[model samples]
Target chain A: MSLAKRIIPCLDCDNGRVVKGVKFVDIRDAGDPVEISKRYCEQGADEITFLDITASTEDRGTTIHTVEAIASEVFIPLTVGGGIRTLQDIRDMLNAGADKVGINTSAVLNPEFVREAAERFGAQCIVVAIDAKCVSGPGEPKRWEIFTHGGRKPTGLDAIAWAQKMTAYGAGEILLTSMDRDGTKNGFDLDLTRAISDAVAVPVIASGGVGNLQHLVDGIKIGKADAVLAASIFHFGEYTIPQAKAFMREQGIEVR
Target chain B: MTHLAVIDYGMGNLHSVAKALEHVARRADLTFKISVSADPKVLQAADRLVFPGVGAMRDCMGEIRRLGIDEILREQIQHKPVLAICVGMQALMERSEENGGVECIGLFRGEVRRFAAGQHDAKGELLKVPHMGWSEVKQRAHPLWRGIPEGSRFYFVHSYYVQPHDSAEVVGVTDYPAPFCAALARDNIFAVQFHPEKSQDSGLQLLQNFLTWSGHA
Candidate 1:
């Protein structure tokens, strides 16, 4: 059999609790990060991602404890992103049992950080998280730009070129999130996903908009993503990971 | 109590590996005194050994040499049930083409090679390096494969793979466009290119099998 396309359920953690918000607004508590992660593992999630959205510096420590708790019980790959600005942050997350650490704003702010982190920690554990927003509109030449600060600030870097540069800088994987389609319950930006997936030699994980199981399938079959990461569909009890996997398998996609 | 020592050389995280073994041990109602350390005395006194590593080959080899784990591994593999995972498996090979080529432990007469650039799968799609994700493992007859189904999916995250001099030493094979040795078994030593701790059910089953495996083929 061939390599299975991974289905990852992302948990947005705030002050150690799992929370969900539409377009990063009107956020509501879901449950405990550890308990939610264990449930996802039981439901056959290939991996679990925890993005720390805590605003206060003191609350950041809570995310580490949360990760540690889930890592002790959940025997699957766990990735921690958001606020991963320093090597100490990366080490703390890995020490807390995270398999990989995703860097977003830091990589754009200092491209050399990706290289240094990769050399020190190994490329296998360093994932570059890119929040991309399409800048070109209607029938024009399609283009996307990298955005930081939860898609609020624009970096003006071409998404495709940045992805290539990151991989060149030794990023093992690319976590691409489409800011335009995120939280819209629409689907992934197939064009954006395919572009980055084909641009880099490292595995690309398609994140952001995944409204249904069909979206997940398209992320692989059409988007060419090696893994699909979604929050709302699997987080809000709208669908379970097993249902998603079963649907994907029915569509002739290999899944674990 | 059976002492299970996980050799840690400051290479990668060993928390998950130790936790998984403890998880399986509790489930199977088996008592195992699991220790994650680099101490020679602790390793020598252990009944079983697990060598788990991640990162560049040169760094791993450097630490192994600094900690004198190379000598300990050489001695332990003679009789104890030893399990090497991921880069730990690659380290057992004679040399690797990573970090401008690094010499390995040479426990097995083989070389570790990187997945060449511009490789394609059957569908003509370009394959990625670091070959990260879950892939089916074609199993051969081995005690470590016990309880785990043949052709089961195991989690893999590596760019380089092992090539043994003797094909008969291979216990499991997987394809990332091309078939490579996924698991190698010889005498009491069993090495794998995937992470059994993060592999969910099939992986847990493999770890469970490893816990109960006798020092024999």
Candidate 2:
């Protein structure tokens, strides 16, 4: 049987350490990635996702060293993203003890890269990430488009359509994030989530805009996402995974 | 003499559970020497045991036997109080689906099965499986519920449930699929589906009660 809905704690790895911020701005030193990951694992996080935001641009290796150190101690699935362009990048990530590899820009630029990665490392090992932002202004409010290079540039590619294509190309899962809601603490964009979830067969992890217990519950129950991803709410001790799952259970969502 | 041994069965969040218990002990104004060990000598010297586990029931039981501490654990449980959380509580059952159809610790006379939507619990569409979160525990005078408020919420995360052979052993119950048992006590064996160490102040009180309990059964 498939796992129950999971509450995942996401760690943003800058250089070699874990960092946090509001709206991904004013970065503050959170702690070592390994230490933070261990804490989350102990607190009962179903899984951990580490996003190396600077790796792709810096031409540095995937934070496999960080993954190895953390995975050696933590006995849970570790999903890694950032700077994952080629099949070699995916191999390095998985070899470093990462259970899955997330690709964003390269997958968008070369759609075939997604297919190739899936061929090399089983579709289940490949996760296509879509960082989308709502663009409304010209004629009928343009659909949410994809962003790359750490949410800095807009690709003008429709997110929903691209998600279907990515899954078609061989991604096992889609880590869809709403840039507009990335650090807002408001809640998730249900419309975008539903659209993509409906378009793809793979599990959709609804990321961004988790402010409180209700937000987590609403994201899963209302948004119909397979899992909910959050950071500040967990890292700051605002709520623990068990607490969040309890609230979700109350709302009748099947969470682990 | 108050050394609390948290069993590292190789399939659980042992360190975090130890830290939480340590915090609860500090809060209770009791000094509890907590450590994670698989040594039988360490298990024997402990005043109490907290059997904490995560993942599948079969894998957990395999770890217990793999570490060669299953017999020692059964022997120790007869003399001292042992608290099992989440999957650790599930391991006390007779069998589980996750174990590739293998038997569990058989500590309790029941099988651990998934929380099927309509079959297990009474409610048609009320409780969901993998019951996660902080929920209220309704108790009727169990030692494990000592000092814990009525309807006080505790943390829980698991899909399988322990159906005790004797109904009286279920001291606390929660409304998930029509009021299932949340806490069980039989002789010196005490197990809860919820994580008391992570349940904040109210949960810490429950841990304190376990520490001081005389294991009178």
Local error of candidate 2 at residue B176 (angstroms): 2.5
Question: Which tens-of-lDDT digit does each residue in B114-205 have in candidate 2?
Answer: 56643333323223334545567888786767777788766665556777788887888886645777888788888888777556556667
lDDT tens digits, residues A47-77, model 2? 7899987776676767677877876555556
Error of 2 at A163 (Å): 11
Put down candidate 1 lDDT per residue, B1-217, tens digits, no spaces: 7789999898766888888899998998997799999999999999899999877788899999999999999998776899999999999999999989999999999999999989988877778898998999999999888888889888899989999999999999998888999999999999999999999888898888888888779
Tens-digit lDDT track of model 1 for A1-256: 6788899999988877888776666687888888889999999999999888653223344367777888899998998888887888887887788899998888999999999888877788899999899999899999999998777788999999999999999899999999888888899999999999989999999988888999999999999999999988877899999999999999988888
| After superposition, candidate 1 runs with Cα above 4 Å error | A55-62
Highest-scoring model, TM-score: 1
TM-score of chain B of 2: 0.91
Question: All predictions: root-mean-square deviation over Cα?
Answer: 1.6, 8.6
Rate residue A235 of model 2 by lDDT: 81
Which ten contiguous residues of candidate 1 chain A have the minimum total lDDT?
A53-62
For model 2, the stretches where C-alpha displacement exceeds 4 angstroms are A1-176, A184-187, A194-206, A209-256, B117-129
RMSD after Cα superposition, model 2: 8.6
TM-score of chain B of each: 0.98, 0.91
What TM-score goes with each of the models? Answer: 0.97, 0.63
